[model samples]
Target: MRQTWRWFGPRDLVSIDAVRQAGAEGIVTALHHVPTGTVWSPAEIEQRKREIATMKDGSPSTLTWDVVESLPVSEDIKKQSGDWRAHIAAYKQSLRNLSDAGIGVICYNFMPVLDWTRTDLAWRLPTGGTCMRFDLTDFAAFDIFILERPGADADFPEEVRAAASARLAGMDGARQERLARNVVFGLPGAAESFTLEDVRRHLAEYAPLGADGLRANMAAFLEEVAPLAQELGLRLCCHPDDPPFSLLGLPRIMSTEADYTWLINAVDLPANGITLCSGSLGARPDNDLPGMMKRLGDRVHFLHLRNVRRETAGIPCSFHEAEHLGGGTDMVALVRAALAEEARRRVAGRADASIPFRPDHGQDILDDLGRQAQPGYPSIGRLKGLAELRGIIAAETHAG
Candidate 1:
């Protein structure tokens, strides 16, 4: 696996120098300032690359802006509503521009309403500093008590509603508001976020388009763009739905292996692939990570490794920033599988040999409290994760 760190360009508090200090040679980033549905110009791509190349410390490490976390799908395109063709064309143009710059992988998600949901952004960790986690009780408290969206009460069970009501009753207005922001406010790089009103409006857009409609939109987008990806030698990897389930009555098309199978089959192109996210898929016990890897390993272009402790009720899961080898996932097996897949790719003479792998969702620890970086992007924690993963990969290489 080729180790890379996600650097959110010049504005990111975690600098390229810091990423180099963390011992990563590659970078996974995007032209974030570029608006959704707009084509990224070649000049813009070159400028971002030059900026990354010229880090403050002048480290000689190579920076490949290969992985784009997301190239936002406009509401027009997602709903297949008016003027979607324009957005689709713009998206294809962006793909061409990115590919022209030699970017290899593009990671995007097809979730309807939300990207990743976290009930608490500053969830305290035992070692100090905060990590992101989804608390069911917190969400329940929000749904049943705070946002008070119509039909929200029906989303939860009777017992959950009682717990939520009790929790809500104890909170004041300020705490409730914070909880709502944490749940819905878009994290950095998450497409367009929603206000409580915005969320409802977004849901209205999807009301006419259920699971099938959303899938069709995704397929249509891929059909239009995947060929351009193949032409430009770029692999388009769609991230699975974050929680791996439906939320707020929104359709989740990428939650299961069946969804992945349908997606790859729809396009039948190597450029169309999946970003295997352990944290997201691991939230659901039914998903066999290793099995999915074996079945779809050929199409797995990128990997997000993190862990979550599933709650019994299935609504909330405690996301722990575990050491790469300490999480619920079978890291060793997964690494071996990934290595085997890469080996197969090499055997088949694939040009991009090193698969871009990053330690996803690190815990906030050490001096990260005052660093003013993106949440869950603490440098030390991710450094620890990368070190652990590197060790695991080394052992796997030796054993093989």
Candidate 2:
């Protein structure tokens, strides 16, 4: 695997130098300032390339922008609604610009409304560190009592509804407000965030689509762009829905192995691929990380290696970020599977022989407790995760 780190931009609390110090061979980033539906100019892309190329001290940062963590799939495109055609055209142009600049991979997700949902950004762990968490009762409390999404109570089970009521009752106005913010203010280091009203409006628009409609829209999108991605020599991968379940009564199309299989077969081309994020998929107990890697290895373009411990034994249950190697997913075995995939790809003489992977979310510890960079992207925490993942890769390589 080709080790990479996600950098927000010049404004990121984690600097390019820090990423180099963490031993990342490549940088994963996007043109975040560019609005979702706008086309990216080569000049803007080159400016970012220059930013990642050298530090303020006129020194080489020893990094190259390898993968776009996302080139945002706009709401218009997702719903095939207002300006949907224009957004698709802009997306295609952006792909051309990215490929022209030598980027090989692009990661995107089709989840509606919010990209990811979490009730707590800094949930304290037993080790005295803090990690992000998604509490079922807490999320339900926000969904039903706080955000007040219509018919939200019916979506959850009776026990969850009761627990959520109890949870909401215990909280004061300030706690309720914080929970709302945490859920809405998800996307780490984005230029802007959505207000609660914004979320409500989006939900209202999506209510009529349901699951099958949403999946069809996503398939239509792939049909348009996947072929262009193949022509441009770019690998376009869809990130699995975070938490791998429904939220705010919205449909979750890409959350399981079956969803990914459907997604890869949607366009049925080399550019149509999957971004195998273990932390997101591992939130569901049934997702076999290593097994999926082995079966879907051919179409897996990017990897997010992190884990979460499910608070309960069911779908839509609570989960908290765990250590990269200590969480529910078997990190060692997953790494070995990725290595085996790389070997096969090399043998097949593929261009994307080595998969680019970033150590995903990490618990806040050490100086990270004070630095407080991005919610799940504390510097020292991710560095520790990268070191552990690197060790596993090393052991797997030597053994092979």
Candidate 3:
């Protein structure tokens, strides 16, 4: 695998120099300052490239902006509503500009409303480290009592609703507000930011679009974009829905292998691919990480290699980010599978043989405890994860 790190532009607390020190060969980033559905001017793209390529001393950092974490598909495009056609044109233009700039892979998600949902930003662990977590009862409390969405009661089981009521009752004003904020926090540096009102309004817009409708819309969007990606020699990968399930009554179209199979076949383009986020898909007990990698390896363009430990066997059960190798995933088996895939690609002379993968999220430990870096992206924690992954890769290569 080609090791990479995600940087949120100049505003990110984790600097490029720090990423270099962490031993990442490439940067996975985007024009986060640009709003959604807007064109990324070549000047802006060049400026970001210069920022990543040049150090503070006007010397070369020797780091390339190899992958764009997202060029951001607009919500309008997702629903095929107002201005969606315009947004699609802008998206194609962005891809052309990126290809001209020598950036080849783009990672985007089709999840409605929120990108990735978590109930807590910094849940404490037994080791005194803090990691992101999703508590079923806490989320139900937010969905049922706090947001007060219409028909929210019908979404959860009666027992879950009862527990949520108790959970909400124990919370004072400040706690209740905190829970709401965390749920809608959105991506750390992306254009989407939401309040309770914004979320509720968006939910209303998606009320009629169930899983089938959303999936069809996504297919339509891809039909337009995937052909363009192929023409421009760009790889476009859709990230799996985080937690891989329905949330807040929103339809989750890209969650399971069946979903991927349908989308891959629907678009029927090689450039249309998967991001293969282990932690997100692994949240569901039914997903087999190594099996998915082995079966879907040919279509995987980017990778987020992290792990999660489920608290129970059920879907939508509570879970927290665990150490890379300590979670429910078989890290060793998954790593071996990735290596095997790369070997196959090399033999076939594929251009993207060594997939670009980043050490996704990490626990807040050591210097990260007080650095106030973005949630789940603490510098030291990720360094530890990269080091561990590096060791595994080295050992696997040697053994092979």
lDDT agreement with native, every candidate: 0.80, 0.92, 0.91
In lDDT terms, how accurate is model 1? 0.80
Tens-place lDDT per residue, model 2, 78-115, is 89899999999999999999999999899999999898
Instruction: Please provide, for model 3 over 123-231, each residue's C-alpha lDDT reduced to its tens digit, 9 standing for 90 to 100.
Output: 9999999999999999999998889989889988888899999998999999999999889988879866998998998899999988888988998999999999999
* Backbone clashes, each candidate: 0, 0, 0
* Candidate 1 Cα deviation (angstroms), residue 360: 0.7
TM-score of each: 0.95, 0.99, 0.98
**Ranking, lDDT, top scorer first:** 2, 3, 1
lDDT for each residue of candidate 1 in 1-400, tens digit (9 for 90 to 100): 8888888888888888888788887888877777777887999889888877876866554666768877777778889887789889988888888877887799988877677788887778666767777777778788766766777778777887888788888889898889999888664754456789888788777887899899888888888988889888889998988788777778888988999999999999999999999888887777888888888998998988776666464543445445556656787788888888889989999876578889887777788777857877888878888888898889888855
Residue pairs whose backbone atoms clash in candidate 1? none
Q: Which stretches in model 3 have alpha-carbon errors above 4 Å?
A: none
